[model samples]
Structure formats: C-alpha cells, structure tokens
Target: ITGELINIINSPDTSEDEHLLSVNFIQADTKGPEFKTTYNSTAQAIRIEFSTLELVLHQGVVLR
Candidate 1:
C-alpha cells in the first residue's frame, strides 16, 4: 500500500535534524484530566498524545 512507502520514507533515521512538536491552549468543558507523552533521548522513535481539559487553571486567571 502507498501508506507503507510513506512510512518508510518518514522513518526517523533518514533525517539528521531533530523533530519537535508542541501543543498549546487546549480547552474542555469538564475538569481534572491527566496529560502525558513519551519520547526517546536518542530520537530513534517517539509518540505523543494528550487529552483535552475543561479549563486548565492558570497563574493569573480570575475565577468566579
């Protein structure tokens, strides 16, 4: 399948440059959900995932 070829081309070892991804400003309508991810220091492989939160508390946000 074409998907397999694309995967082979995108394999991490093919690139000398570091790959980085960031997520920001995710909001939810409920409360208290956990957040996490996993990445190897060697950069051989990586996976990232996160769950949406209902209103992440901040340092300066005024609460009613």
Candidate 2:
C-alpha cells in the first residue's frame, strides 16, 4: 500500500484550515475596500508615469 504524508501548518491561531495543510499549493485570497482603493491608486499612478514618458518621446522626436 502507498500513502502520502500530510504536513500540518502550525500557527499561533488555531483553526480547521491549519489541519488541511499538505505538500500542495496554497492560494491566498486578499480582498477588501482598502486593497481595491490601493490597487486603483497604483494603476492611476502608473498611467500618469506612462503619459509623461509619451511627452519625453515627443520631445526627442522634435529635437531630432
């Protein structure tokens, strides 16, 4: 008979999810109003940076 060993994840807080740990992938799900606000703000910042890059490219073309 073949059997796979189970690895338990020990933490300070005890819970049922801790017992289900094994040598497998663990997907962490993080979702909330704060996360959404931060993500949207980060995307907006990147968009602003790219828009400035376009200005630099236009300047280079004009300088040529």
Candidate 3:
C-alpha cells in the first residue's frame, strides 16, 4: 500500500506551509511477520508495515 502525509501551517505574514511524505510497502510470501511503526515530527509523517492475508469470499466474515 501507499499513502501521503501533509502538514499545513497558517500565519498572518506567511500564506501557508505544507509538508509532504510518501511511503510504499511490499509483502512477502511468509507467515507471522512482525511489523513496526515510525514517527517523524518534522515531516509530520507516520508509517506502519504489516503482513496479513486478504480474503474475499462470496459472503463476508462476521465479526462480533
């Protein structure tokens, strides 16, 4: 998956400030892979990576 982050700043003298971040993820053919999170304050970005299976059945699974 891919995503972007933006930070907006407003000021009287300045018009506007924006910060952008882009990220991508790759999946492996493995089981029970661990993931982690990262934070960047200056760039105003957060990233997370995880591995899981996505299934699409005729009827969706029910959750309680």
C-alpha lDDT of all candidate models, in order: 0.33, 0.35, 0.34
TM-scores for candidates 1 onward, in order = 0.19, 0.14, 0.19
Clash pairs detected, candidate 2: none
Candidate 3 lDDT over residue span 6-29, tens digit each:
323322232234223335555433
Residue 50, model 2: Cα distance from true site in angstroms: 14
lDDT score at residue 19, model 3, on the 0-100 scale: 23
Best first by lDDT, ranked: 2, 3, 1
Of 2 and 3, the candidate ranking higher by TM-score: 3
* CA deviation > 4 Å runs, candidate 3: 1-41, 59-64
Q: Global CA lDDT of candidate 2, please?
A: 0.35
Top model number, lDDT: 2
Q: Candidate 3: global Cα-lDDT?
A: 0.34
TM-score of 1: 0.19
- Cα lDDT tens digits, model 1, 28-63, are 323223222232123233346433323444343334
What lDDT does candidate 3 reach at residue 25? Answer: 51
lDDT for residue 29 in candidate 2, whole number 0-100: 29
